[model samples]
Target: MAKRALSVLVSGYTFLEGLRWHEDRLWASDFYTGKVIAAGLDGRVTEMAQVPQQPSGLGWLPDGRLLISSMRDRKVLRREPDGTLAVHADLTALTGGHINDMVVDRAGRAYVGNFGFDLMSGAPFRTTGLVCVEPDGAARVVAEGLWFPNGSFITPDGRTLIVNETFGNRVSAFDILPGGNLGPRRDWASFGAMPDSDDIGTLMAAASIAPDGGALDAEGAVWVADAIGKRIVRVQQGGRILEQIDTGEQGIFAAALGGPRGTTLFMAAAPNFAEHERRATRLGQILMAEVDVPHAGLP
Candidate 1:
């Protein structure tokens, strides 16, 4: 991997996450702004939907409707062709934690993850589960005992699903069984073992890797936004760091491979994830860099 400067696509966002490329547009959710946005190559921005509680992930259905994760409310909102937002799936009964990010499969089944603990309040670590929501709105927990499953991506063939466990310091892979259930699990990459400390500050300081949001490339590699490392990394199946881009002092919470040929790597950057501090300023931005491989698979 080579070190280089990333170009700024847009600025003045409160906080951005869940970046994706669809229908020639770049979509993402701005947590503090409470809006899901779409931007073009020209940098023109559009508000696609509003998520009052907080939005962290974005995806689309096979029929072209949009799916956005409502973080605080523990629900997934669907945007119809007419632009009205409605409860697509309710995940409240599946977990005691808040929902965070998701990846909708080709059949319109969505795989979602959660916070596992009260992050903003500094609660100790609590294991969480991943939920699968059918296209018709049925929901169920498919996997359990995960440590903060934050970002996810499905392979081009839709046979494998890779999820980034932020606090777990690894990216886990699962076989996508028929009807959206997860099969056997294995570590696709492991930066280190789970931290020994339960305290947030101690765990963060001692942690060597924290894989955040991610996107898959055509070459079967995943580009990850490592929040604690303050950089984006390309990882292979056996935990290899093939490429890396330093983000200087900023924290990259999420990333997506976009652009006409899908060679553009888009990153959501901020100084930190503090809610109050992010809402107080507009320092968040959508940063971009060119990569050799184009994007592949689900967002």
Candidate 2:
């Protein structure tokens, strides 16, 4: 496939976290600001709802409600039609670490993850894998001992689930069993070694490589937000980097494929996370690129 260049859609955000395509709007989250926003196809940004804690992931329920992962509270939330957010499930007791990103199935079952360790303090904590949450608020740990799971996506056939191991520098695959439980874990893709950095501790660059989020394309390729590399990479199913689109910024937290034709690749980028803390800059922004391939599964 031919490589394409990235284009800036808009700029000036606090800290872009999640990117999703729902209905005619592109939904996203600003973790630092605790705000979930909906951007129109015409580039109009509007506030959808605000959560008390950091919103990490976005999903839709069978009833058409919005499902969100509240990172700080370690819970999954549902936003009703009246714009009220309610706790759908509390995962504190099920997960050994803080919840991160998630993916929900058509059956309304959500697969959630934990940091496994503290990211900000560069400290080692507990290791928790993946958990499956039902609509009724029941949860079960389906996988374990993953190194900081981040972005995740289920295959169109609903037979496989792929998860990005942020700190581990790899993507893992599992069988989607009955009732939305994950089967045995297997390595899907692995980045050999992490880049060395003095400022970011002995942290593996591979872990933070695809830090925040990513999406799957129509050709069965995984489009990952390579934060450390300041680019978005399209990886084939067999683990080859097919294309790379540079962001020209530091922190590229998340991405999605949306637009009128569903071929527009939307990237959520920002300067270094530390920069947001310094001046409270609206540094986070959403950028777009017209790719030849369209997004495969739900955005």
Candidate with top TM-score is: 1
What is the lDDT of every predicted structure here? 0.89, 0.78
lDDT of 2 at 220: 86
- Give the alpha carbon lDDT tens digit for every residue of 1-299 in model 1: 45666899989999999999998989989998799989998999999888898888888889999998999899899998999899998888897688988999989999999988898888887878899999989999998878789889999899999999888878899999877899866898888776576677876776677888988999899998988888989998888999889888899999999899999999999998888899899999999999999999987
lDDT of 1 at 136: 89
- Which ten-residue region of model 2 has the weakest summed lDDT? 197-206
TM-score of each: 0.97, 0.91
What is the C-alpha local distance difference test score of candidate 1? 0.89
* C-alpha RMSD by candidate, in order: 1.1, 2.7
Candidate 2 per-residue C-alpha lDDT over 1-299 given as tens digits, one digit per residue, 9 for 90 to 100:
56566666666768777689888788987786788899886778888888878887889989999988888789898999999999999998887666877888888888898876566665654446898998888999999977678889988898999888766677888999887877898878876655544333455433535545898888888888875778888887656888888766465768888788888888888776553372377777888888888887654
- lDDT winner: 1
Off by over 4 Å in 2: 1-5, 193-200, 205-208, 275-279
